[model samples]
Target: MNYDEALSYINDKSKFGSKLGLASIGKLLEKLGNPQDGLKIIHLAGTNGKGSTSAYLSNCIMEAGYSVGSFTSPFLERFNERISLNGRDIPDEDLAKFTVKIRTAANEMIEDGLEHPTTFEIVTALAFLYYNQEDPDYVVLEVGLGGRFDSTNIIRESLCSIITTIDYDHINELGDTLEKIAYQKAGIIKKDGLVISYPQKEEVVKVLKDVSKDMGAELIFSTEDIEVVEKTDYGSKFNYEFNGIQLNNIKTSMIGEYQIYNATLAVTALLVLKEKGLIQIKNEDIYNGIFNTKWKGRLEILKRDPIFLIDGAHNLQGIEKLSGVLKLFKYKKLILGLSILKDKDVDSMLDYLMPLADIVISTEVSIARKLSAEKLADKIKKYDKEIFVEKNIKEAVLKSIELADKDDMIVFGGSLYLIGEVRTIVNLL
Candidate 1:
């Protein structure tokens, strides 16, 4: 199949979506010769900051003179973004070629009495296949959802498993409470392997400790001795003082106070790798990688004149972070365009955004599970009855640009799909 056809074929599996099992993925990979076993991976899992943490870790690995493969989820601007090597997205021809091979393997699985692979399972298999073909020194893999049953779990023991901060997302599949979510995220921690985690609530921390003990795995809590000194719009400066471990100046390209935690996780993972004698990473590599890393759509400032900002702050925790950042910019007028999954806390998200928005414009993207534009506008109206609605995403973006003054900001986010659409409209690709 071609690229578009491959996309359609893979996405069609969403009809039998979210099987929540590794069996299908395992079988699918077996048919593809289990390429995941040929590579070393720093497997990352969490509700938020997983992408940023992965990006930070990939940068550090690259700075160590290693060609790294990065596999993330829910592409921001293109499907190719989900897979990358040395910070470059997978080429279109490579993607099309791999898609056809995986499709054939998946069909064989179905003919062998196995269910067709879910969309994530197929993508996961494709990543393993591509990464093995390229033979990168390190692969930074981000879990698509809760770790236990997520297809990405099909990998062998990771070099180190890093769990970032967790919050309420995919509640049905994972669990409701923070402790339950922590359990699911900790599922990626393998037997007798190294696991690194950031500071979390008491309940989550307790769960991690319990699970770590049960699995015979060594768990390193970053908050046990690390701290962030200060933060600005550009980056953060911090000292990560692990017990009898390295104390150094760590910097990250990702903005926001929470990114400090992500940097700590990445550093902690590197230290774990260092202890294992798998790599000899330097403090300069950490500093340079942190500054050089780039993961888009999280508090991304696209243009300055009208201040076009795009963020992937879809959940309550993410929305709260976005709200905190929005408070810093002193823009008088705000134009907003948001498209999100139906399962998201739309009302809670609006509670944070509506207070800041002067003109709230709503629109839907091309996702199958996108919340309706009219429904989103109606919900926003409940928060601020004067909000406007536009069904066309590009039109909504242009409307925001039209209404904003030079100092005003046009903030578009709610889903990565929305950010992807804005990138297309603004020719940011």
Candidate 2:
């Protein structure tokens, strides 16, 4: 099998299961010798920031002279991005081989009258199988959806679990309230294990605190003693002090305020790993790890002349954060491009975004769930702003640039799918 065939096989399967639970995933892993049991895990879950947090943690551990495997969701560029090692995607040959192995095992299970694993389940199972063979020192597992029943949550144990900023998302499957969503994300906390959380709403934190107590797990919020010394368009500089670990002037190349919070959570988790004697390293490793951490699609600058950029703010909470970052920059005008899914809170997202944009270009991503460009433009028309519709993302990219001057900033956002295509068009991917 080749990479294309492997991806086709996975995409051919159902996106989700007929029922929601871990039975099928557990059975599939058992059939494959439960490779998930052979690695140490740092499980992560939240509405946003999972990708950034996972990137920070994995880079740090790898820089500390240890191998790390990472499994994140919703690839921004390629399918291989979902499973990576030491900040690199899994190789094409290995992905094809493992997908074949998983298919054979899944077919056997069907022959035995068991339900076939869903797309996420099969890919997640492939990650475990590959990681077990490579035998990385650690594995960073980012939850694909709500954590409680997410396919990645099938692991039996973890060294630590992180819950990044939680908000209203996937309400139908998780819940509508913050507390209810917090309960779902807190499900990744293991019994008598350690869990780290970014600062959250009062109610959300309460739910997390209670869940940790009930599970006999210890919880530490990463806000213990974080002080941001510098916040600029260039990057961030901060001082972190937690549990006798003093990190001064820790720097990250990532922009925006939220990335600072993610960097803190990642550093806290790494300190725990160090305190437990998991790896040998010094402050230099942590410093280099953070400074060199690479994450795309969130306030990433694609061109300096026009300052063209892209972000993955598909939900209301994410839009709010992106708006916060945009507030800091001084530009002649904001030429914005957006393409979002049909199920999102479109009106609320536009409410936060429309006012900042001088000209809005609505585009449709080449996905089944995308909100059509014409319909999206109609929604923007109510805002009484300059709106343009382009069903082709490549055209939208060219038009956004055409609408921009060297002094004006062009930002493409509203969906990860849009961001991925923009990156590919701009040749950054």
Candidate 3:
């Protein structure tokens, strides 16, 4: 099969629709010899910061002169962005070959009366197979959904499990309360293993502490031990202390003050690996890794003249973080372009976003799951009367630009899908 055929085959499996269990994936991987069995994995799960933490950790490990593989969801630009080896996406030819092999294994499962794997499960299986063949030294795996039954949870254990800030998201599947959501995320913790986490709400902290005690895992809260020495719009410099060893002047290219916490989580995880002799990463390598790390679609400044920025703040907690960062910038007027999926808490997200905009242009991504522009406008009108409805994403972006002066700022986001489309258009312009 070719690249287009491979994508079609994988896309066809989406009809299975995000089955939240391990049975199908387990059966499929078992048929392929359980490639995830003996590899060193760093499993990450949370409502926000998983992607950024994965990027920070993987880049650091690769800088230490080790081969690293990362598996993340909802690619920003291309389908191949979901899996990478040492920062490079899997070659299209390799993806095609792996799809052919996985397709046969999936067929066997169906013929044996087992359920068909979902699209995420198949892509995860392919990642495991490819990593097994390539034999990377470390694999940084991000949970596609809640951690407890997520397909990536098929791995029995990980060298380290990292959980970023837990908040209310995916409530329909995970649960409603913060404790319940924390339980699902805490599921990635293994018996007698190590866990690194950001400072969380009081309820979330209690849940994580209880789970760590029950699992015999050692939990290290990164936020309590790290300090942000200095920060700017470009990056941050921080100091982290662990096991009586303190490192200062650590920097990261990823913007936003919240990223300091994410970087610290990555550093804390690396220190755990160091203590266990799992890898030999030095302070210099950590410095370089943090300095060079880049994860797109989070407060990314695409242009300077009109100050175009795109962020993937699709949920309430994420929107709050984005709002905090936006307050640090100066602009003549804030022109907003927004879109979101149907399942998100749109009302809560708009509550955080609508007040900050001088003018809001409601738009929709070209996806079945998107909220219609008119409906989004209805939500925005309740908060801000200065709202415009533009059904097309590109047109909405252009409209924002047309309304903004060189001193003004145009911030377009609410969904990663929207950010990806807007980024593509901005780059072309």
Candidate 4:
């Protein structure tokens, strides 16, 4: 098996569709000798900020001079990015090697009258196999979906579970209300474990508190004990205090107010580990990690003049955050490019973004779930902004550049898939 073959084997499983249970993943892992067992895992789940939060934790731990392995979803650029060791993607040869091993196990499952593992399950099993072989000091596991039954939830234990800011998303599987979503996010909490989360709505807090109590897990909300000393377009200077760990005059290059919550959540989790004597970490490690950790495609500025920015703000809550940032920039005009999955709340997202743009171009990604460019343009046409349809993503991006003056800003967002494509094109240009 080779790289292309590995991708084909995994992508072929997508036809089986997604499932929200652990039975298949559990059985599949059992055949693979349960590589997730005894691994020090920091499980993360929520609607937004999980990736950014994972970045903080991974970088902080690695900064403390330890090898860290991270498993995240929705690859921004390459399939290899789904799993990484100390910020480097898994080698292509290793991915192909694991795919061969997993394929055998999957076929055996089918022979025993069990369903084939979904694409996420296969990839997750691959991650476990890859990490277990390398034996990193820690594994930062980002849930592929809702936590309770997400493919990554196969582990029976974790060092800690971190829940980033939660909002309405994956409603078809998770649920419609914030409480329902919180319950799913809370599922990553193991019995008698430690859980850290950002401050949330009252109802969400109640749900998390209830779940923690029921499981005998200790839950701590990263208290809103933070003050923004100063903020620039690229980063912020803030003072944070919680659980007697005070970080004053800390700087982070990640933009937006929500990232402060993510960093704080990560810091709170780190402090808890330090108190329990789980790992050796210091204030300097925390400071360096927070200052240097980077997650691409989230508020990334591609160009200086004309301000070409791309963000992975796919859902309503995410778009709301992006809109908040857009209001602060001084520019001649806001040229926006959008492409998102059909399953998202299109109307709500457009409602938040349409008003901010002087011109809107609706384009489509290569995925089957994407909303067509023409249809997306049709929806934008109802709004007051001048809209265009460019089915070709490259053409769509080029048009945005052509329309923008030296002082005008161009923003390409709404989907990670879209952002990845645009990032490649912009880099080459």
- Cα-based TM-score, every candidate: 0.94, 0.97, 0.97, 0.98
**How well is each residue in 1-429 modelled by candidate 3, as lDDT tens digits?**
999999999988354577767888899899899999988999999999999999999999999999999999889878999999999999999899989988999889889987778888889998999999999999999999999899999999999889999999989888999999999999999999888888899999999999999999999887466778876767778888877879998887777788888888888889878988988999999999989898889889999878999999899988998999887788989999999899999988888888889999999988788999999898887774588899988899889989999999999989999998888889999
Model 4 segments beyond 4 Å from truth? 13-16
Candidate 3 to truth, TM: 0.97
Candidate 2 ranges with C-alpha deviation above 4 Å? 13-18
Model 1 lDDT per residue over 275-364, tens place: 779888987888888888777888877888878888988899998988787775767787777887788887888888888888888888
Per-model lDDT: 0.83, 0.89, 0.89, 0.91
Give candidate 3's total backbone clashes. Answer: 0
Greater lDDT among 1 and 2 belongs to 2
Sort all candidates by lDDT, best to worst: 4, 3, 2, 1
Q: Extract clashing residue pairs from model 4.
A: none
Evaluated against the true structure, the overall lDDT of model 1 is: 0.83
The numbered model that scores best in lDDT is 4
Question: Which 10 residues in a row give candidate 1 its minimum summed lDDT?
Answer: 13-22
Clashing pairs in 2: none
Better of 2 and 4 by lDDT: 4
Total backbone collisions for each predicted model: 0, 0, 0, 0
